[model samples]
Target: MLIDRYNSQLLMVDVQERLAPAIADIAGVEAQIAILLRTAREMAVPVIISEQYRKGLGGTLPSLAGLMPGVQPIEKMEFSCFANADLQAALSGNPGNATILCGIEAHVCVLQTALEMRAAGRLVFVVADAVGSRRPESRSVALDRMRMAGIDVVTTEMVLFEWLRSAAAPEFKPVSQLIR
Candidate 1:
């Protein structure tokens, strides 16, 4: 199915300082997420970033913050951002009923958020390359679980292209410039 840009928002889930260093394939995941953020910014997509607990886990990565300035970061204590009331309100106010999810700890925050979003009647599309876990098995399990729950699994480039929708679009140059 085509990713409806007008009906999509980027939800960057906890790419926190202390947690990110230990995740598997950390470098690759970071790179992909950077690209994803750049694409989202270039395309005027709204982004919601959640810091699991700022007093403990730390803020979203600097690279991500650089791309999405003034992102409505929903600080949460819950493992899932969906569990927070303020986050829910932010989500409901967005133009999209679809979430393009990314960030760390694939089997935990990423997984939980995807499932909850789906349950809330929002279409969840995860950027696989932008998600990671300390244990590969755990990450794989989460992906399986998300797929089982009918979440649409996608990669960073796929999301970029899908959001662009057509090569002839006026934003084509800026969007395509991201991949290069």
Candidate 2:
């Protein structure tokens, strides 16, 4: 299914300062996420960010956090964002039913969150290139598991183009420039 800009929200899981360094190819993941964030902003897609144990993990990376000024990151002890009341409340408040996910530790937080969101009957899409774990193997397994469970695993470009739909879209040029 195409990701309609008006019907979807972006959920960035724990891509914290302390946690990011441990993820494999995190720089690449972060780059992809940056593209998504830029596209989401241009398309007016709502964004929800979660930080697991802010005290320990620090906060979202300064570079990434800068991209989202004025947006508060929800703090949670729960691996799955759905399990945290605050995050759940934030998500519930949004009108969008489809969620685009990206973050660290694909096998843990990202994976669990995707599964739970799917279970809740919401359309969930995990941006594969924007998610990672400490071990490539772990990330691979998590992607496989999520796919087996019917979650739509996608890439940043796929989402960008899908949301744009056509060159006639006002956001097409700006969003297309993001990937270049």
Write down the lDDT of every candidate, Cα atoms only: 0.86, 0.91
lDDT of 2 by residue, 1-180 (tens): 899888889999999999999888999999999999888878888999999999999999988888888779999999999999988888777545789999988999999999998888878999999999999999999999999999999999999999989999998888888888
Q: What is the C-alpha RMSD of each candidate to the true structure, in Å?
A: 1.3, 1.0
**TM-score of each model, paired residue for residue:** 0.94, 0.97
lDDT of 2: 0.91
Task: Look at candidate 2 and give me any clashing residue pairs.
Answer: none
Q: List the residue pairs that clash in candidate 1.
A: none
Q: Write the per-residue lDDT of candidate 1 for residues 16-134, one digit (tens) a residue.
A: 88889989988999989888888877788878888988988788888778777777578998888788898878777864568899987899989988898898888889988889999
Ten consecutive residues with minimal summed lDDT in candidate 2? 88-97
Tell me how many clashing residue pairs each candidate has.
0, 0
